[model samples]
Target: MTDATLSRADPIHYQDATTLAALIRKKEVSSREVVQAHLDRIAAVNPKINAVVTLMAEDALRAADAADKAVAQGAVLGPLHGVPFSIKDALDTAGVPTQRGSKLFAGRIPTADATAVARFKAAGGIALMKSNLPEFSAWTETDNLVTGRTNNPWNLDRTPGGSSGGESAAIAAGMSPIGIGSDVAISVRGPAAFTGIAALKATQGRVPFTGHYPAVTKRWWHVGAMARSVGDVALGYSILKGPDGIDGYAVHPREADAGADHIPGRLRIGWVAEAAFGPVDPEIAAAVASAAARLADLGHDVEPVDLPFLGNPLGALMTLVFGEIVPTIKALAAGREGDLHAIGAGIVATPDPTFAAYLEAEAQGEALRSAFAGFFERYDVLLTPVNPMTATPHGAQELVVDGKTVPWTHVMAATSPFNLTGLPALSVPYAFSSEHLPIGIQLVGKWLDEATLLRLGAMLDRKGGLDERRPAL
Candidate 1:
């Protein structure tokens, strides 16, 4: 690429994947130019943010060239043709190191791409790099023995939330236009909120978890999309959604419709600032209320929702997840426990769950889902805070919310319920805190109704006024 080409494509790195694809298809910019621009941006900014752990510069450029050739030949293009996207290191990418931020899997490369990665590639997107994550992708913050920590591009001293932290940081920093991240509870949404990006954790089965780490039978786990814009999240989710023949749990009962015309003129939106979601920070609560008011002004039926049964499920989630964690660590470590990361060590030290407790947690999950089902029957969407607070300082194990100190894990309060209920949820930056950190609001939709979340998210994305600001990186 020439200096002129690099200069021209520089701003393209920040454009959403959907726009990039359209530009490529129209021959306004070459795929190589797009890929190289991102590679350059990653090289320039990643050391400061440390989001990308393994970059596939050569392979990506080669793929970009092939995409340009296809366009030159006038071949029909996929919706994401010529786009560059990152993958959370937790997801497998064939022939590329798929280390899930643990030394145990360091340098390990898979022979086949994770279904999500394969779908992106199949749609003509380039695998730009592998983003960082907590070891085994089990922590709420992105730090690991394998690749160290991924800092928030917005504030280097703070974390970018995990286990999708790196993916969000990369997108927020304009290193990659879009990427895929796994979410058992809050991985995708938490990171997106922390980094001022947009992400969607579709209903659990909407996307297959076939090649993600911690290959467990946890029904609450999900694989989803993280992008700088809701439009990109919508596009990426559409490509990643549908069942892969291998993952029996992955099935889409209905196709997604993100078209503006498909959305109703008015939606019944129920919002909750606190109560069931634990003690939310005042700023976060205000952001949720602001989003609700914006929707109300747009002629939607907006009301504060109170559901006693919809309590924070993070405790139950821990009971189920930690119960599996001990065994999963032992099996994956395979007598190499001494070499496991600190998080893995901590997990192993935690007491195993009794059969009764595990069963009770399962029942709690079932009840949570049942409650959400009934609530959705009354409301088209539920609005809440994505986290109790904005991004926290690196290594912070506790957080103070509304004058009370709570364990850092409480950040998952608003997010884990939807995971347990298997509902689609969107996280989009709504406002900034006094500290200038981005605060996000969560939009939860009925199961298999990501289209609704995406549609409403588009509305919020436009009015949130966050699109005008990029991290001062």
Candidate 2:
């Protein structure tokens, strides 16, 4: 195809993997051509966005060639065959720099791919690059000493959201069709919400965490997909779900497909209008109310729900995340502290603990999990603002929402409880703020009930047509 034809007619850059696969099957486009279009787009757009920090240009081309050859032989193609995708730098990719957005592991390369990455390759997805993340995958904003910060494509002055912020920005800017991102708290959903993309934080352990840096053994971590649409998230999840022998936490016996059938008509949705732990920005609260109104307009039953156990769970979660850093901090700092990140360096510099604090965190987490179970018994799904405000300016550490200064962790308060509960949650774009910044409302479901949440998200997507609205980059 000529460059003009590729630029104008190529569906690969903007289309989801499922749509691209069908086009490939019809010979409307070749896998090699489609992959090349994405590579060209990446080369063109990535410098401004700083989304894909590590490029696999040659490897991506080789894989695309292989995919084209398979098609030429009439070979079976997976759902994501020849589709270009990116992974958060926190996930391992064999022979690639999988630096977890830290200077400490500046040149660290992995010998094997993370289980989720392996699954994507097995499903015929091509890895175009590795996206950016927070240092050690610890923070919500995607900035570090290694590769600098990833800017939001919508407005470069604002952040994309993190630690999966890079992936969300890349997908939103059409840098890649879909990308893999992990959610410790709101990493995936928050970024997706901010960038006007789609993301799913699967029930914990649904996708393996093996080969992830700063290895998460405590405070349940989940690997999920960031994409432009709900259907794409479902397609990616289907490919990445299942056991890999290496990750003990990888789900065994397989998870039943949780796509969209679980959504019911006249659904009862519990709406939390305010931040459970802190005050929400008025615009964000209005966005949530607008989404709830949309659901009500569709005849879904929407009612206010109060979560009294929020503060304790968040406090316990912080203790858990910060407590894990103590060891890493000591090791890195060698008992000397400078900044908080340096204190983190000291924790890493310290010796490994024989009796770790993870156990205590786990114990507290169990109580919080029980509280969420009781809460879910009364609500089919919970709707809350994904972030208290719209996208914050890049380099913003503390935000003043309603005249109260709040730390970045508060951004995850409305979303993280579900992570601790091992429940499924999705961030769906609700409406744009008066500033034209995107605002999203999260739909959270009971444990292992992602299908219900996704169905509701799809219903919202259809009703609101949010996907069609894009920031003019």
Candidate 3:
């Protein structure tokens, strides 16, 4: 759906949040119509993808009625006045079940919303439902004891990359316009790349993490926005940004660039074809190199630059995540350890984290952060592949790359570095494989500099927003 025709009937199913809001404000469509369109889309597509697990139909419809009334009364509206949105199950939503894809919290509900969700509600967005994620949001596949597994809309035989896999699939399937997602390693970017959409991992603390499940484990985790366009990402970011006062890291308020729509300068972009973390598929590498060439065509300075400390980010990430997470699992599990997911159970089963080991990982992480910050001194942005290859088959830990098997952790290599460094990164769709799966290039910017990433992302998005073809559900 193009921006020019957003008010049309059938294609409103694929429009972005900003356009939907405009349609609502102009009375081209009522909020109830917009919300019901998405709910109907969910009913049609969700069974195949299993992305949206729990439906808040009655509550969402009630909210949509209120939004429509506000529009009719000419009440001042927030940017997202009446658009439909989804929340990841990992985030707390008031009166909404946040099962976290595990039996341990099967009927869990939060009395208060996560800061992100609260802000979305305040913006006049309708919360339609909760999307699926990995149990405790721990691994890279959206399967647990609860919602089963979420498959890629592009190919049901393949997995939709997780831990925000369900959100990506739901968005790709046109079930929701924008949703909240968290990333510790590659959760947001990997799934966005695999599903052919947009997702942001802003600098550490750029978006508050308060009220998110696994609330505070490892400093690398972040909560950010996912949508069909970079403009929508910026819109969501504008509404969700700033310190919630509770998360020590989210210390700043909204920025001037939150309203800025264009790239300010010809950015000097650093491009890395491959890093030390893993081998890349020839197709994926070619796609990223093409993106760099495209930027050069646009008259930007695009050149290759070596990155610092790309070795074994999975090792560093796991070291820090388990070190921080194991203690919490032990405390929460008590005698019900068996109820936890295998990944969670294993963390509890491991020997207690040593202070010396945690200290060592912290030191390494700090150095990595400094290295990325220093690299940004030479270039305004860095570009790399969001993943080495396309989505893998369900339950397959090893990917058959170039006729050789590689560990599943390779999917996260390019993206995990930004998590450690706290630099902002965004996944933008670029190309497709011979088999018709999606490929994406990532743009990394300086700390708290999400504006530049969104700007470049908008440029890339204009070429193709969702895809040349939508998923045939």
Candidate 4:
């Protein structure tokens, strides 16, 4: 749907948040109508995909009415104005059940919104629902004792990917135009790849992790925007970023380029396929090549570049993440062990983390970050596959890449390095697999250089025509 004909009845829920906000500002469509359309879409599709675990139908509608009233009264309006967005259950929503896809927090509700959620609300975006996730948003597929499982919108027999799986599924299926998702390693980018959407894990601390469940393990954690289009992700990021005063780690060393919308004339683009991560699916590798060729076609200097620590950082990343996460899980599950799912139970059962190991992992992480800092000194953007493969079958424990089986955990190979370095990474769909599953390419940028990443993402998105195709749900 083009902006020229946004007023037409063409399923307003499928429109990007930017367009919806513009339509609301122009009064071409009432906020109630827009919110109602998404609510209706959720009702119709949520049952099949199981993405939205909590529905805010009445509250969203009420918020929409207030937004419409603001428009009528000519009150100063925020950029979002009347758009509705989904939230990953990992984030808090006041008076709304967050649950974290765990039985322990099944009915838990926070009195205050997460910093990211508050920013969205302040920007005029209404909270539509809390999307599903694996227990404690830990696993790579969305399923838990409380919320069951979330299926891919394109194929119900497959997973939508996690821990941001539900948000990706909801946006890809048009249930919500945009939403927030957290990434420790691959939560945002991996799921966005699995579900064929656009997401950005901005430089760590760009978006505060305050108010998110299991918050202690945040050294490598990041909250980011997920949408079906790069523009919407960019819009959401603009509002979601900056320090909220409550999260000490969050800071705005420098603002993203005001001219991020305009890509600088030509860029030094570097892409890596299997070299960065071993054994990528043939089709996914081709997608990376296609995107590189397209970038070259766009008059940018494109080449294949490799970093020594690319595929080797996952061990250290996991070490640091699990070192903190295991204790947090054990503390959170003290009296609730019986309620824990298999994954959570297993996590809690792991041997106690060692301080020596923790320090070693931290050192490894610092070295990885140094490597990336050095690499970025010569390149503006680094491209790679978001995952070695596309969306896998539900509850998949292994994946076949290049006709060889590898543990599904290999899925993080292409993504974990960025988290270790706290560099900004963007996941944007570039093509579809032979079976028609969506394929996404990752774009990594220098620290606090999300502007360059998003700018290049816009060009790739435009040339790739991501909006030209949608999941045939």
* Most accurate candidate by TM-score: 4
Which candidate tops lDDT? 4
* Per-residue accuracy of model 4 over 316-429 as CA lDDT, tens digit each: 888888888898899889988999988899889987668998898888888888888788777788999999988899878878889888997899989988888888999987
Task: Decide which is better by lDDT, 1 or 3.
Answer: 1
Instruction: Give the clashing residue pairs of candidate 1, or none.
Output: none
Worst 10 residues of 1 by lDDT: 1-10
1-473 per-residue lDDT for model 1 (tens digits)? 11222233348787778778888888889999999989999988998999989989999998999999999999999988989999999889989999888889889989999999999989988999999999888898999998898999999999999989999999999999999998888999999999898899988788988888777744878888898778889889889988888887876644644333434668888999777676888888888889999999988999998879965488888888888878878777878888777888888778889999999988999999998889977888899999899999998888888999998888898898888778889998778888888888999988778888887888888366564577887
Model 4 regions lying over 4 Å from their true place: 1-4, 7-10, 253-263, 465-467
Candidate 2, which segments miss by more than 4 Å at Cα?
A: 1-11, 257-263, 275-277, 332-363, 462-469
Better of 2 and 3 by TM-score: 3
TM-scores, each model vs. reference:
0.95, 0.90, 0.95, 0.96
| Predicted candidate 2 versus true structure: per-residue lDDT over 276-330, tens digit per residue | 7458988788767777888888888898778777655665565676666666545
How close is each model in CA RMSD to the real structure? 3.2, 3.9, 2.3, 2.0
lDDT of 3 at 2: 36
* Model 3 alpha-carbon drift over 4 Å, by segment: 1-4, 7-10, 256-263, 275-277, 462-466
- In candidate 2, how many Å is residue 293 off? 2.7
Candidate 2 whole-model C-alpha lDDT, 0 to 1? 0.77
